[model samples]
Target: MMLEDLYRLLRSGHVQAQGVVDTITQPIIVLDQNLCVVTANNAFIKTFKADRDDIQGRVFFELGNGQWDIESLRQLIGGIIPRAAAVIGYEVKHDFPVIGQRTFLVDARRLVHPDDNSANILVLFEDVTERQRHDAEMDFIVSETRHRMKNLFAVVRSIAMQTETKGRTAADYRDTFLGRLDVTLRAQEISVSNTPADFEALLRQSVNPLGAERFHCTGPSVQLSNSRIMPVSMIFHELATNAAKYGALSGQDGEVHVTWSLEDGPRGRVFLRCEWREENGPAVTMPEHKGYGTELIQATCAHVGGMVELKFHPEGLNAVIKFPV
Candidate 1:
């Protein structure tokens, strides 16, 4: 019977029995004052895998080999329903005999007949397995985002404090700090997007602005880990900036060569070896003291468990960076 018909039956002071429940697609059951099943809808029959004849007029707990006879469930429907107006949003998660594990959100309401003081309990079941799974995934993503943001803030704080210590003047500090910050932002973008940071891609992002034709690079395809991507990119940014200002990239005839390889190391470890060579530039001379850019490169390499050797040849600047993989 449809709800319209059920409403008519109620108006005529006649209970339509279980047939009225079939109107709802959500698993539903009409129970008497004793909590015995009066009638179950088609949805309930299919969801619980029960015969209509076995369920009608039988106690709800006695259905499906007594799988529904749980302590918490009894407390909700048996203990609370008789005394309270209704029990709304009660959740039940259990494995049935043939249906396997499932989650359900239950809503039970006590309905008082207009003609009599006697009441009937209408229980509705909503399958929430998929909803709960989606909610769990969302929660995990939120938690991971918080964790990454915290880590990023820490990294920025470290950079600020260290830059302040090494910077010679406000101008130097602004330029150096902003350059390093750009590298950190790139790493964060890659991590959030869940994309692999290709070594070539990061190199281009750092140096291409200086001039794509100013540098020559040769290396096999390598994807960098999140922890290493920021530090490595910062190292390249500092080197490229120095080249653009004073090294090979400073002149039209000057250029830089960058090569890298992965090799086996002692103690069964792997190592990444990279070399930056510059040529055809102004006569090279070593600085009397370490500059902010040099310090930035060294500190970044140390953060990622790597080492860098900077040397000045008459031709140009040569730097070698190595790290364990």
Candidate 2:
């Protein structure tokens, strides 16, 4: 082709290339062999908050007050671009004046001009802030859930020891211990089948035998881990039992209110605070000695790193339990 025809062809290619780069949604920049920014797409300017005039033709490392001059990144691109097809999934964390600390996955490839054999680097950036945040939250939840499960298992071990002390023989111990174990296992199964157990559903199941009308349960829709379900259900069971035998649930007009709320606690940690308040019941007196039921409730609460306060008020019985969420 003639020189004029070749120039026209190159000019057409440049226009087509610019149109392609401009259409990309991800931040993209073209850099020369010396790491000088040859051109940047619209997405690049918008994403990094840079002007076309300020970035185009400038050294990439000097852009944005040298924010792009990452040492490890420079080494990565310098070493990989020449020998390999591309350097893919290179992570870069930068704090821009316009945007706070952000994470980006960068891909760089060598773009060669066939006519002159001159080469440039085409770099693409994908923002992964939301993905990283979601992964971190999921990891935390899994870890905490595992810790809670371990604590619950420890509580079961303690319960076995306590129950063993009251048994007359091996057979008696087996019967009593297994009976309590069965309750825990059943609760565990229920919770496992429905992971992140619904607070309202668990409460309803625990007090269903005592008659739902005897208890008024009100709380926000909160989900608790499987480990949390058994201990909490047991506490509710104990409360319902005591209510039916001696507290509010004993009388025809008596009632019990079980309300809970999630609130910020000390040091900015969040916790769930639940209250079991009885009303219009037979007068109650504080027990001098802690029974198995009381001990079980206290032990379970302590195992989960929680606090329980029980008050034998003249009007009725009130118990409050609070634990981290």
Candidate 3:
């Protein structure tokens, strides 16, 4: 019903007005020209955890430890309502005594009784805390999706540029590039999926094709965040590829041992430390220059706030990768 109709009912009689106001679901209050509470709806009493007897005839600002004494609300009631006759959707955020934090869209309307020259202000409260939180969550999801897409594109471009095409035919180049792309896409899929990606599972998947017997892996269970998954997956893929080509996996008697642990770093930061050690491999020596694989590994590690250290000992190739979890 209109504010005028409600006001007319309220002016008619207190007993009848109480019944009518109680029917409304939204919390409402009627205040005299002096800002004293004339009557409050049952919804208002329930919503604010107030007693009707205590609120009636009390000043609005003095009620409930001065919670209602907000400066903006004072302005809306004293200054704006007098001139505008109505103030719609005046939002207020406050920590109420019993309700904790809440957001409300307040609508105030000035009411007049023509016969008696009486004036009162009608205030309506709409709880909008949940709606605001949902809106914020949607905005975050949209921003996160855009950011992930941009990063995915950049990663694809870098991988394409770094994939070596020299000393390879068109088919070989296509296979090599596509293999890396597949690994990247798989990582992206896992990162965006509803289920969290397991670090050990990811490592195993990257090196599983080389025969499980050629490698031994052990690590405590670790779950990776969405932002870290792609880069970590790429690091694992590169390390496995390099091992299969030039390290332990290249020889029949060689074996690779992968182990990882979580450690507390300086300043209480937790870090993931992984070691890739090869044994019984052909004599190893440091390359004269860094190859695309090595660069890719280093770049991916740096992308995730991590570092990779490679050691080409005479016996085998050893790598230590460290990054914040």
Candidate 4:
């Protein structure tokens, strides 16, 4: 007879069932026609903390000191089977004496026994409490970020309104507002990407589009919060704009020295310091009038629990900013 005529499910008694059962990663529970545990995989034993001798011939629910009496979970799994299109899973809270309470993702499927018209169930699970918690936290962050951005826009509008009323002329107000927006945008650039980058790389990237070729920057490496890149970028943008207009960057020999390092950590205090200095510029002086850019730089630094020190010496303009680590 052709080999295709033979039954695959009716394995010979010599066939090693234990060898196959131990190889699966997903927890597998094979129940006999009576819905009694016939066998379980190593993965299943580890997951349920029940020994093979203890679980065999016993009902799955009553196997582990009745600890697996997760009602909704059993119902969800009781409905699924092999090649079945249903996506069934449940979260079960297990409170072991020493381990406290934890949530696990239990997924189950039923399979038709090839030899008999009976059925078997296989359950797989992983602890997903931490994952769920993290997802919730991330969602909160996203909502908070949107809220903060809207508030910031409102603040920008207020600055625009005040500057329009206070400026000497309409053109003066227009120039001031445009500069203000650019600074604001630059300060927020680093947060635009989800990736982490060193401080100097971030600053260099922030300054590039704003006529960076006309300027030079030097700095050492320092760790930085990914979200803080944007505000700092704006600060640098304002500083760069000022230099291009009236400071060292306006001159051929003008250069910007940007460096940073960590200081001794104080008790319960976390801080990092960064300095950006301008060189070979004409004499500098404070502006006769306050504008949005100046206010933005000060406010942004302060918001980050830090202060920005601005120095206008004959050589150039320099700024030192400290922020919470």
On TM-score, the candidate that comes out on top is: 1
Please give the lDDT score for candidate 4. Answer: 0.68
Q: Which stretches of candidate 2 lie above 4 Å from their native place?
A: 1-15, 79-86, 113-116, 164-325
Best by lDDT: 3
Could you arrange the candidates by TM-score from highest to lowest? 1, 3, 2, 4
Error of model 4, residue 130, in angstroms: 23
**Which residue pairs show backbone clashes in model 2?**
none
- Candidate 1 per-residue lDDT, tens place, 90-129, comes to 8889897888898888888776567745567878999998
C-alpha lDDT of residue 154 in model 3: 95
Residue-wise lDDT of candidate 4 within 233-289, one digit each (tens)? 666676766667677777777777777766655566667787878887677777677
After best superposition, candidate 4 residue 215: deviation in angstroms?
3.7
Q: Mind giving the per-residue lDDT tens digits that candidate 3 earns over 1-325? A: 9999998887778867667889999999998889899989889999999988999999988898898899888888886445746779999899998889999999888765677355788889999999999999999999998998898799889777888877668897787788799998888678668577888888888888875788899999998777887778778787888778888888889898999999998778889999999989788878767777888888888887788998888888889999988
lDDT score for residue 124 of model 4: 62
- Give the alpha carbon lDDT tens digit for every residue of 282-322 in model 2: 88888766756677778788888888999989889899999
True-vs-predicted CA distance for residue 216, candidate 2, Å? 16
Residue pairs of candidate 3 with colliding backbone atoms:
none
Model 4: lowest-lDDT 10 consecutive positions: 79-88
Clashes of each: 0, 0, 0, 9
* TM-score of each prediction: 0.83, 0.54, 0.63, 0.48
Candidate 3, residue 196: Cα displacement in angstroms equals 11
